[model samples]
Target: MQFSIYSKPSRKKAWLLSALAIALLGSCGKAPVQNQKPATEVKKAAEKPAPAQAEAQTGKVVVYQLFTRLFGNSNNTNQPWGTIEQNGVGKFNDINEAALKGIKELGASYVWYTGILHHAVIRDYSAYGISHDDPDVVKGRAGSPYAVKDYYSVNPDLAVDPAKRLEEFQALINRTHAQGLKVIIDIVPNHVARHYQSLHKPEGIEDFGANDDTSVEYKRDNNFYYVVGQPFQVPKPQNGYQPLGGEAHPLSDGKFEETPAKWTGNGSRLAQPDFNDWYETVKVNYGVKPDGSYDFDSLPADYATKSVQQHAAFWQGKDVPNSWLKFRDITFYWLDKGVDGFRFDMAEMVPVEFWSFLNSSIKTKNPNAFLLAEVYNPALYRDYIRLGKMDYLYDKVEMYDSLKLVMQGTGSTDAIASVQQGMADIEHHMLHFLENHDEQRIAAPEFAGDANKAKPAMVVSALISSSPTMLYFGQEVGESGTLDSGFGDPSRTTIFDYAGVPAHQNWLNDGKFDGGKLTEEQKQLREFYVKLMTLSATEAVFNGAYQELHTVNKTTQGYTDKTYAFTRFNDTTKVIVASNFASTATSFALTLPADLLQQWQLSGGDVELKDMLSERKASLKVTGDTASVQIDLAPLESVVLKF
Candidate 1:
């Protein structure tokens, strides 16, 4: 994800130079052994059992998306565009038992370790037998993780020993599972780094473009879409763009030779793509013809309702394309290594047929594997989930965008009901998040502009449906993504540069992984997040039926458009969640309609209600057919009432 909207290039360049210089001081060789103990002993330390095991797998999957390189960094230097040595990179070794435990305490069922895959970066790793990528083809000091270079290996920068990078990642996966948390890594199915090459792939597994007849523009078995007879030409720098800030490099002549040029990652077929295009990567082919026709058979209509086993059976006799088989093999390699799931990037760009074959094959091995895809087209949601066999799709364009409107005080809670109603059939297949690597931070001036203002929205995101909830690392501590890191703007954390997060560093507390350094207000905000996530993970009602109360109360006396309320309950537990999005404190008598009263089997009487978050008690008076509860809410406060 790119974030270049709020940048100050002049100042950022200085910091970038400092970081690069510091990184340059290092010898290009295998790093010193982190610990004198044997490999087995060091592995044991990483797998140390936490004092408290994470809660058992619940209906709700709480995901914590940690940008692995930055999660453990403690340096406060934060010089925008600094080098690895200046900013300090967080190794897989740095995510220790204490760190995992802290994430578990926040109630994450899965830890999405972003940027784990081997990706193209400008870092010089020639000493480790890895070729350094040209800055002309790379996107930042540290390149975008989405532009993956190798599917079989982990990023070498994340490992103490570059040769043992895979082993280090495996240890991390083991630690995550030990904490009762599953692991999710990114799989960029639509494209790969411009210089895609896997030096560490398993034996007999051919590289993506290997054995391809590059003379053809399109082929059923070719892994890439090529522009026949044309050579790839680097786009001239638009918008004052420069290769590595105009730094002189032996290979920085704005030229990359690729005869029969491949199509750009975003499907721009031009030999010279625009600078704003996804020029750092190239699109992967999946048997779709130039006329948008499929070169493969489509899934039968009945497959939507069939079991994953049946789905797998359907593909048994078919001869799938080369790209499909390649990705399937990649998934199996990781699944064999104990990866629990994948967060597929730009999954929709690839044909749904490929997903059917890929996902079915995955489920046949691990039925409980979490398959969340980045699909924003609501019209295609059901098809991807049912026919394509995906487990979840992002609710970004609708729920997330709507919630942002509510949080910004420009929208109504009325839309929340409509959103839920529209997705009633596929509610469980949607995933919700208030902050992620791609979105603007809630505390950033471009977004809510205040972390506290996220409380109400967080409640709606987590408690509104049975869908999984995701939290970006440092979100709880209100890490405003306002740093002007090079190649990226403020308002979103820098995924492209090695920079320390100020607020998150406070919670990291110099690797202690405790909140000892957080201010009182920051601590309180984190506590609120803990309560919210904890309830979502352990509460049975979150997995049960949901009914929006805002629609019924819109015409009520004191209720405003900025307030949203909902009810979730199972056979034995009931929860009423309400949020106030206004600026000042507001009081309202939340009314439960007759249908809800009857659903709860409550006649006309007084029932005690307890606030699950603050542990305060209040009484709900049931009169006639509806129940009314008077509540005083602080601005941006949300309450979860349990009966």
Candidate 2:
């Protein structure tokens, strides 16, 4: 279900957008049309019906993150919801057409709208360092959908009638099914929009210093333990910031920074409670201005509140709505929405008890719901999986290190060995990706010169890695950007590179903004990816555990540095993944281990490698004492061969 991630102005050649179309290049697709059988049953016609067949394996969940503001499908002009000026672009009159088009184009497993809720008041809409005007960021008619003033209301900018959004959304989900895709939506659980109903009347609420809290700072681990024996502790705000109470903010007279969540540079380590209040401007607390410089964090965290139990007298005696107070309600909401899983937002901030409670309840509704956390450390990964409670977290350390080695022209089994080892017990729980929403794109703007090379290499690594893959919006489709130091560009991402942009649309008729040219190369790569993913879905080794097999080749630069080989073996399947990152050809000593020698397979040309990438042949050969493979690693080139 994983789709293309590439999206942007950065392209390789004129055919850059058509890159993923490699699957269809000089080759046939998997029975695009089934052969029609004769009307009369002549083959095995007399036989009686056999027993029912068992169900096939579960399907992978494909999630597409939609940037509503940039969807420029003008075809919906007279459809429904009135006309919506998406950041001053053409208006969308209907949602169904867009939905239908998205399914037809992306072949997504799920359609995920990044933010669609409504906010009564909106002043500040900046996320990371980017705003709506950025080439990739869309400045819709309303504002940033993240700043939700009303949870129940869908942003009219996204779907005109707030009441009709759910229906359209359901239709979109149905359309996804029609294309063999699923649908997912983002759910922010940590903090409500600053202008939440409770914050509507901030005049009556108690306001304390930012990051001010009554929390008793515990020694090393001085926070409430969600579970009985765990050493996990909640983080307390350093600057004494306390959470707001009871009332919400009033109708805005000014910007959001002045609202309750605003923080001054007054203290060092202060944590702002609300991300943004709808009324006046409030500075959402990010990292602190350090002693000499500052620290930019990808995932931001705030202090945890006293447990609902500790304040026994406060809520125990009084009556509070369980729907509003109970944390488990969040899990139930997604379940009701038919989500297959949740990719937790800044999970470290949410207590483990929340997960334990969620895991227990989620299974009751749907035994197959999966949960993935987004943390980037290895040690924490051990604790989460070791305890057998949490699902998976980010493994950036491994990815970063591996990428660093690959870029530097040096790599080893030891480079990614540790993480591979740690994944032993929880392979199914692991979530893997080359790039995601929070981080910068893998192919940085540096690729303006040569995305041709950057893409193949990057794609190979992502597809062959050992984890349940998750891709940020445009990666599979070749979205090239890298904004690590600041918030990425606003309009720089391709949330709109979808069904609206046809591969053969006339550039003159559609105008440049319609994205007709963007998919030219990516479509090739995406189709290739589809074949690879479909193959991976059927191949146990690709989705399961992976191990590295060392090759002691000494002559070629890439034979060692340019090659990446992995072996995935479980009780039933054994898969060997070998890749070369060098732009040129390389040679591996044709020495097969005892286990491999026993299997009968062709060498080099004799053994045609059906690379999952584009379902094309990755040139290779087995010669005397050496098996030679001429991989097109012209620059950032990569290929995965399975034997």
Question: Estimated TM-score per prediction?
Answer: 0.92, 0.59
**CA lDDT of each prediction against the hidden true structure:** 0.82, 0.38
- Top TM-score model: 1
lDDT of 2 by residue, 228-284 (tens): 222211123223321111112242212222221222111112233221111111112
lDDT of 2 at 366: 61
Residue 72 in model 2: shift from native, Å? 5.3
